[model samples]
Target: MAQTGSTYTKCRQVGTTSYNKHMFLNSECMSAIDCAIMCKEVATCTAFTYDDLTKTCRLYQKIETINCELNKENGGITFTKETECHVNWETCGNSCYFYEGTTRRTLDEAIEYCISQGGYLAEVTDEEELDLVNSMIKGSVLLGCTLYDGYWQGRTSGQKLVFNDTMWAPNEPRGQGHKCIQIWKDHGKFDDISCLGIGDIICEKVSILRFHFIVTKASDL
Candidate 1:
């Protein structure tokens, strides 16, 4: 599986000499992978140093220089960010999303587009996720819900709609013939819209974390 978020390159026996002032977020992590995940969670963290002896991860908000000195006395692993974004997707909670802004597509076309990306139309399960999706979309966008036999169901596995009553706009669904659902970007509210309508699409898939190993000698640092 592919990893999500920042890329980390590990360097051993090397520690920053004068950039300690740039340290920002710090927490205890089980492994280097956990440290990388924590660094990715912090928007400003660009690099991190993990102390194997202390089991602590130190994140840096900025790296003004790459200078490093041999510190064999201290057991520390430094990871620098090579890139951001997990593959071609963005991380949100436990899922990865791909925002389509090229052109508006009908509901059917949107579904196909998401499938092409190895995902499906975004399925929102809670208010938090709904807000996350809303933040990514500027305008109305197609969701996974579709009308079936007078009831709304998700396009995948025919899962019935069980959203909270508050999720719907006041007097929404309106018993209209509209068979598809679109989420309003402003408030994360649901509204039934015509299936033929064209709108932006959000694709969702399971998130994976990728890790790459780079062994650097003391002289290479």
Candidate 2:
């Protein structure tokens, strides 16, 4: 399977069946990487693409994204199971992760990790919980590491934004540069923070949107 830009530990080598729980438990293909296994709380598990030519399994990361004909629950596809998270986050696919890669990256790198997973920054939808999310960070150990020192200037990786469709709050960066806006309850005033400021982050599947239906890189058949 093609690695997601960065090397990870013991991910499934091949097959649509991921999450090590019941490896290949619900598969039909006899000589190929068949079936995809989703966990109990997994809301989205899209169709997996496993190429015999390349021997790579590309898992679609989305909530209710994968649409496979439900065989018997016993006919589930099990892949390499890593730590499945069930924190206070929404269900994307069969998993809900706050941080994509826990390698202590800056805001931009972390955003890349999320997009690579077919998502964006864990944008908070409400103000009340958004405030709590900010207050909750004062004493807790942060998730990502900072690449810059002083300012929260993390829109450097260049993601041209169009927030006119979004609720661009006052004092929020409307121009660009420090364009990657974040949320916080600074002094109970909901304000837009920069992505550079280290804080807990999360990513939930927005919708079942597949970017490409072809494999970019994989082993030859």
Q: Specify the highest-TM-score model's number.
A: 1
Cα lDDT tens digits for candidate 1, 124-194: 75677677777778788888887888677777746666778877877887766888878876667888788
**lDDT of all predictions, in order shown?**
0.67, 0.36
CA lDDT for candidate 1? 0.67
151-211, model 2: which lDDT tens digit per residue? 3322322222222323334665443434244443343332344445554344433332222
Best candidate, lDDT: 1
TM-score of each: 0.54, 0.28
